[model samples]
Target chain A: MSETTIGGIAGRMPKFIRRADPAVVTAFACIVLLLFLGSLYSRSFLSPEYLLQQLKVASFLGVIATGMMLVILLGQIDLSVPWSVAVGAMMAAAAAAYGPVGAALAIPFGICCGIMIGIVNGIGVAYLRIPSMIVTLATNAVAQGLMVVYTGGFSPQDSATGAMRYLATGFAIPGVPNAVIIWAVIGAAMVFVLTRTGFGRSVYGIGNRERAAYLSGIDTRRVVMIAFAVSGGLSAFGGVLLAGYASKAAQSMGDAYLLPSIAAVVLGGTSILGGRGSYLGTVAGVILITLLQSILSVMQMPEAGRQIIYGVVIVAMLLLYGRAPASR
Target chain B: MKDWRYWLAEQRGTLLALAIFIVMFAIYTANHPAGFTANVVQTASNKGVLLAFVAMAQTLVVITAGIDLSVGMIFTLTNCLASWLVIGTGLETAFGVVAVLGTGLLCGAINGAIVIYGRLQPIVATIATGAVYFGIALLLRPFPGGSVNEDLADALTGRLFGVVPASLVALFAVVLIVWVPFSRSVLGRAAYAAGSSETAAYMSGVPIRRGKFAAYALAGLLAAIGGLFLTFFTYTGDAAYASGNAYTLFSIAAVVLGGVSLFGGKGSAIGAIFGALAFRTIGDLLFVFDFDPLWQPLFQGVILLIAVSLGAFALFRVRNRLEWFL
Candidate 1:
């Protein structure tokens, strides 16, 4: 409580803050700036409704990025995001078309579909030793093809029953959005799993140094597989929410999400290379990216100009945070 | 025989894939005998020429422990530039060709500079540049439309001599050019050495940076060639056409299938050419099979996974056995 003690604390605080991951700080700064800009541009941006709406949009991307973060944390990339989303949506929507029984089928079908893709990605990365980027890229292509072939580019619509519809429109507390709840729950669960679980430690361990991790007797392959499966499942979950939101799945609906998901992950102080990152950082990143896009939309920028800005913003963020000295 | 075995070991992945392609071709011919006729093969070869060039471009960068995702976008830029230039210029047809080629080389140089000098990773760097290149192309002609001389397209598509198409001739020329320098030049050897291990190469005075820069520049040049062929084949330039889509992935597949290690080093241009051919043949076969267009991407994904898996498994097995023997 003394003046000298307070000064000492304050001075040390700046150094501690400076040492904080740049991505986390940037994410925080960006969120504040975006909110400020959004309020200036549109009064509605400050409103609870607008914030909830933004959170709703962020939920889809945030969840997927959480999964993607795991894969990227493992020093691999997955380009199959769009296709994976499409496949998940199509399978779920198609399954749900048959009624509540079908609707119930959608969740497992989507998760299972993702799990399978994750397995392929794991085997490709671990056993086969193919680059995750190329393997995932190819898998994405295959998924796209399957989506088109199976659905003929036309998803059979499932009736959005009250519960399904509640996913997007309903909120836990009045004006507090169901999406926000779902996102918080998922984020909390992931944080626990990432921090407390053996698998989570293995993920960090393997990502940091696979050889060392293996030498330490961790089941590296299994961890990677589980990570990818979780990623695939989360992506599927996003697809399902999207389906519920729209009450229908459309072909290529996942396309817009691919870049945003990666952008979110990158923005979340997690190194793109495996070994060092956190779900908390990912949560911050998701909020930051969502806010950026929402603010841009509120600004009424043209689609092309928005894309140009999107690319610029992402590159800038990467340059600032990407130099973590831990990259391979 | 030992030397032959070593050579075979060096190129086995590509050769195996090529052998599979031949068998696939035979089956296709059996199913559609007319499809394998000389003119058909020539047409397929011609169609594959751009891919072959792009694959070569991809291989160059890959050999340097890098990748060029911007090749397709650069190709778009060149194609658009060709259209823009050819339309306004009073120059001879030869001059037009030179200008197009120049455009591509310049694009490559820019990419090379960014990647090598800027010290950016090839994947992320090319991705950003790919966007810039595509944006430039779109800025040139916003619409999915442009004009190219029909006569030029005809010449590009037509046979050079009675025996071979102009496209085929051009592709062969590329192969010859890439192969000679890659196989014989000290620079090429150094490039490969750098790719295999940058630190070791640097330690041994391999001019690793120079080799990387040159490899990237070569990749850009090859991409430009792909653009030229694309212009001729399509007879038009669309800003959105094949920008950041299948062409980049296709080129990688062709390179990988041809036995070029995705990890960098250990592949041949000859193998890349064949890989291109095989990819095209399979694409054609897919169409012939009446597979839904939706399934195409999935099938390609499966094929790529399978190919990469096989190659990776083989590589691991070989390394393990080598260690055991040693």
Candidate 2:
């Protein structure tokens, strides 16, 4: 190429980059790369059935990530996911043991437990002015302690109800998993809410600049509280599903989901700083993380290695996309 | 009158933290079957000092408006490294100590480089590096069997002059050597400036990048010191994941209790030290009170929430409402 042409292309590169959503692009690219790597590790990794199973697994993370994304988008966070999930699963399982009414109310009761936690989280952040990080973390400890006391510090005695098991492990249509279907319904609802509603606009506004949103009559506090509540409920729902899959609730069962949920949300290109992101990006992120996880496990990499990779991916992505303009 | 009031306001957080520690320690000693003796004090100091060091490490980063989730991992890594190196002859042990501490400095430097130069967020960057540090720790002590020099370990952890705890003395010396100089230094002031308002700091020509980098790097060094102490106390290294995570979380709690603001640019390491002591006392209180082990987490959480909520009372005076977001 001519010198002038090369210079022109270089000069235009920043502009073109600015127009593309880095989170969505990076997530999709990672997914493709992970898929290729997975196939290389095991031929069956490329099969439709294997991929579908991965999607089913991703669905749980997806459900939780959806909630996390809502909070992150509001420039706040919910660290209560671990215990919230535990509460949901434990409550659902415990309620399931009582008979027909208990079984029927299991899911709602589980979700209600989560919403309650979320509301408390919301009150702390919105009204008391406590940093969400501290409040949620404190609440998480409280939940853990409460659960331990409730269970007498042993494994919970209750097992998942038949319906709970069906929701988690059962197939709905010929080949599709029920978990995937649930995730899709949630995802679709979220996409619609984020794209078409005043609440969505309010969330984006509040995330971008809370004071500005409030000045513009957004009722920012209410939006934040509701966002947290939704996050809590969804996280608990994810926990309930996990309990269903595992057939019982165990102490510290929700402990594993906290970091991965944040990872998935950020991986999908949702800005950890909030105010800008799409659920589509989050979906891509969830799939990519799941695939990366599968590939790593297939290689017999240890848990420590998996955690390191997970952390690295998050840092790497932030480096790639989170940087502000150099000229500034 | 005005000057003294201003001074009081400036020192309020530290004073509050100190008051909390004093009250908690007093209650703890009063309830103890053994009462307040050197043996009891030594044991408590040994436990409290480890967290105090870690909290001090956390304090530096928090002052710059950043958090180091990796401090705990760095503590674990150094512990593991110390177990392997802090052994043999006097000169050899000395060199081993330097090596372990140096590794910690390097870990902190990496975090600083990524956050300051690479422009990544502190929370995410540290989380990633923390994982890497834990991974190395796991590799070093997969089965948790390694030893430190017995002479060095006992000397550090044991009582000094049969009265005061050696660990407390060591902790004070560290505060004198590391924190005092850093807090007075230009870079330290720069860190405060940056945390308070980075844009203003930048506009005023403060070396915000250097200040933040120093805070992060020093944080790693402090965490490493905690690790060395861990090795001394335990005489072995175990790559305990839960323990590491717990330390990270508790450090934040300690910082808050110490009067360090999460929003940054405030508070003293001394306060955080006392906060660490006070928090450790909460657990001891549970033990002495004969509470069920199961109630410990719940009580700790409740106490932390209450302690932190005390800091939030000032928000009620905020009139603009916009300041709430800040």
Question: Which candidate achieves the best TM-score against the true structure?
Answer: 2
Estimate the TM-score for candidate 1. Answer: 0.89
Top candidate (DockQ) = 2
Please list the residue runs of candidate 1 whose C-alpha ends up more than 4 Å from where it truly belongs after superposition: A1-19, A34-48, A154-162, A324-328, B1-6, B33-35, B88-103, B182-187, B241-243, B288-295, B315-326
lDDT of 1 at B35: 60
Q: Clashing residue pairs, candidate 1?
A: A73-A274, A141-B297, A141-B298, A142-B297, A142-B298, A145-B294
Per-residue lDDT over A49-128 for candidate 1, one digit per residue giving the tens place of the 0 to 100 score: 77777778888888788789888888777777787777777777677767778777776787688777777777777766
Q: For residues B1-326, could you state the per-residue lDDT of candidate 1 as single tens digits? A: 68999988888877876897797777766666476666766687777888888888888888877888888887777777766666534466568778877777777777777666655556666776676677677767676566677677777778766657788877877778765666567778877887798778877887776777777777778887787777777767777633446788888889888888776767877788788878877776776676666676667767776766666655555644222111
Q: Report the lDDT of model 2 for residue A139.
A: 88
Candidate 1's docking class is: acceptable
TM-score of chain A of each: 0.90, 0.92
TM-score of chain B of each: 0.90, 0.98
State model 2's lDDT.
0.88
